[model samples]
Target: MSDYQVFIGGSAGSIAPVITILSSLPADFNLTITIVIHSGTDSKVSISEILANHSALTVIEIIDKEQFNPNTVYVAPSGYHLYVENKHHFSLSVDRKEYYSRPAINVTFSSAAEAFGEYCIAILLSGANEDGAEGLLKVKRHGGITIAQSPKSSQVDIMPQSAIDNRAANKILSPKEIISLLLEYNDLA
Candidate 1:
């Protein structure tokens, strides 16, 4: 987890697991965590604030062209497609929705693979749709490690299952297992 940048994507019943993982990490965790969740346009929920309250790491809704830093948790803003413009900054767009989602998981995950390559670690969690599979595949092809939440552990199995089906995930793990693996990576770092 030293120079690695992690991208997590989820929908439907993913919040609880996200909180669990974030809260379990140390304050000095040395990786950048970027998250994308589908909350829809009509929703006014503040996911960044909610995550911030549950974790020791700093959490913020990503601002357009924001410069990213390690140890911070960045949540993609709703209704915009979040992209890693480069290794240092992020860009946002009102691009046409993919998989009926503006902040599509595929967009960020693919961008992260290009920007970080083998240093990228992407995780696709529970979701009702198939948004993340292709992007996760791209990451794996780029030599990045990709993990999909075990279907048995997901409240909604479609998303992670799609990744598994597409051969995108190098590992399929439960939430608890995911946390442990992350800590293991940190230890190696």
Candidate 2:
């Protein structure tokens, strides 16, 4: 099996696409999937539970130093930044927020790029800010695949548009198209 790790980042208008993507993946999906979505720091809701409702795969909020495993979905906790310490583990931080948001896309994406290198696949979805653009670029520079949701197909275009504008995306696709690509990759493993 491939050692690819998928890192998905999003903010406003991202939940629907995230649900759609996770729901489409089978329980035995071959890659480890990690997510970082901007959420209110004080909110008590669990994004992992919401994703669990849509996915057959195990979905849990990330704990510091937790090991990565295939066939599971890990959600970055609110009010913390998530990082891929290596292929086998994750680290969480309470540092200052980036782009005025904790669980910043850039933090996760850049760290995943560093940890996984060419085995990483980074996806940038609908959001209202430019937080993920530079990090996606870093992923691309590190030889990882970088995908951005097409602006026209997004609930809010700013985030994906920013990544496209910065030439960070290797592919610009609709949400369903992104799912298709993931399925194809899954099949290859």
Candidate 3:
């Protein structure tokens, strides 16, 4: 089976759904997940820690030039842009923010599209801005499957709606549907 990498991006009201998706995956699931969420520098709690509490798989806050592994969840660090350097590693940059936020979804999603191509599954979740729309489009153009959180399920519809509006999302689904689809993809991988 081909290696599948899942890239998820979100901002407002995305954490709960992310936890739901991760917690549902078994410990031995044979896929990698990388996440980028727009966050301010002053976040009081560690997102990775929160995710780890809910998930059976290991959850890590990505470090610069860190190697990636399957069956693990990686969360992008705040105040930097996350880039998938290749299939096996990630690189971080402190470049200027996009869409008024650092760790912009666009940077990571676009990088994943380049690095993983058709092996990637890109999901755009709830957010307040249009940051991830173009990146999701790139993922689609690269032959990756792209999904947008259904506006009905999103706390803030602008993010996924933008992807849908741009015709980038191949599927628009609720959180439960997203988890089901991801589990199916894991089986294929």
Candidate 4:
């Protein structure tokens, strides 16, 4: 029952700190990081590729009907929403979008709250929209730990600000400090 899921929010112009912090984390740890990065439908920065050159952890844009594993990273594909079913596997929904966003950040974090409950850790990083605010709140509602990038230090700040404004995130820090928090919590996990 040792499981952890983190939802990170940030734009391509904003997530280098996130990638750096997460990539430096131990690859064999019991936790799993699920990143919800923003990209235009045709944009080319592969989430896996960015992390591949940095993390020793296995990383992939999770596919439907795929089995879940720890010590790996799962990313939601560009056009589909990502969800979890009982923490055993992944699910994708392309029917509609939430928060005016396809592949919505809220959808992912809320679903994880259902699947992982208090074991989840939700993080909100830099971005231009308010996509992940309520979702991070949902995580907190279910007893999960919520961390937000300090809006003052974020490249975009809006995304993280929204979460903090909504009172969703419990702790706020810069990306480097977030890395320290993650390592501390990983030890706690």
Candidate 5:
């Protein structure tokens, strides 16, 4: 499997299929899944518990100065942008929002693109805006792997379309298949 960090971008219309996929990984899988999702109508939802409930993985709302771990998932908080301090640790800030969004997919992805370089993999799943396009561009420019759910399967098509339009994504598959690909990377690694 590839020794790359996987960054996922998805909508808040509901929890995403990609989340289900990431949560299903085998216990021994050697990877971390950092998800950047749109916050819901209320910022008080217990996303960590909700996601952790069915996942075979651990989930946490990332906070400043926390160490990261493999076989785990970090959910960016509802109103905070999640960022990396080192490849294996996390940081949070409310200093500003990017692309008019806090917990913006673009900000997190762009940082991962630069921090991990070729060791990063970015996936844009179901969502409504072009928020992830610039971030995915950063990934592509830095030689990171990029994936987008096929717009046909996306509940909302704009995000994936934007990535495709800019040639920022490397693969465009349905959410179900992304799990296998991520597992394949884990197996190879």
Candidate 6:
């Protein structure tokens, strides 16, 4: 299989959709998945654990300078910005928040677009702000595929809708539809 990476970003009301999509993916899915969601620094629950509960893929919080591995799910740690340093590794930063978010979707999406170029797939899910819009545009500019959750199907439409308005989305789909497309892309459907 080709070495493609998938980046998914979301905020308020996005956890359910993310879990739904992750749960639908098969265990052998070969692409690496990196996810960034708005999280409170004091939150007691681990997002990685939550994702692991829903996904057959190994899920872990990204560590600075860690190497990327396929079939694994990497979640951005709280209070830090996540970036793909290259196709093979990740880097974290303590930079000031963008859009009032530390692990901003824009940071991950833009960096992944640069690192993976055409081999990347960027997805924007439910959020209350316009964090991922410009990042999605960057991904599209770098020849990566950009997907946004359909506004009608989103819990909070601002994020995905912003991507649509920016003309960055190659496709707008619901969580279930996104899962089907992913499976089809990997020839698992």
Q: What lDDT does each candidate get? A: 0.93, 0.92, 0.92, 0.79, 0.81, 0.92
RMSD of each: 1.1, 0.9, 1.0, 1.7, 1.8, 1.3
- How would you encode candidate 6's per-residue C-alpha lDDT over 1-189 as one tens digit per residue? 456788999999899999999999988998888999999778899799888999999998988998888788999999999999997899999999999999999999999999999988999999999999999999999999999999999999999999999999999999989998888777731
- Please list all clashing residue pairs in model 6, or write none if there are none: none
Task: Tell me the TM-score of each prediction against the true structure.
Answer: 0.97, 0.97, 0.97, 0.92, 0.92, 0.97
User: In model 5, how large is the Cα lDDT of residue 134?
Assistant: 91
Decide which is better by TM-score, 2 or 5.
Answer: 2
In candidate 4 the C-alpha lDDT for residue 131 amounts to 88
lDDT by residue for model 3 over 116-164, one digit each (tens)? 9998899999999999999999999999999999999999999999999
Per-residue C-alpha lDDT of model 4 across residues 1-189, encoded as one tens digit per residue: 246666675653455876777667886665778888777777688766777677877888888966677777777788888887667888888868766666888888888888888988988888888888998999999999998888777878888888999899889988888888777767866
Cα-lDDT of candidate 4: 0.79
Q: Which whole-number lDDT from 0 to 100 does residue 110 have in model 6?
A: 94
Instruction: Look at candidate 2 and give me any clashing residue pairs.
Output: none
Off by over 4 Å in 2: none
The clash numbers for all candidates, in the given order, read: 0, 0, 0, 0, 4, 0
- Per-residue lDDT of candidate 2, residues 54-158 (tens digit): 999999899999998889899999889998888789999999989998889999899899998898999999999999999999999999999999999899999
Residue 145, candidate 3: Cα error in Å is: 0.5
Which lDDT value does model 1 have at 189? Answer: 74
lDDT of 3: 0.92
Worst 10 residues of 2 by lDDT: 40-49
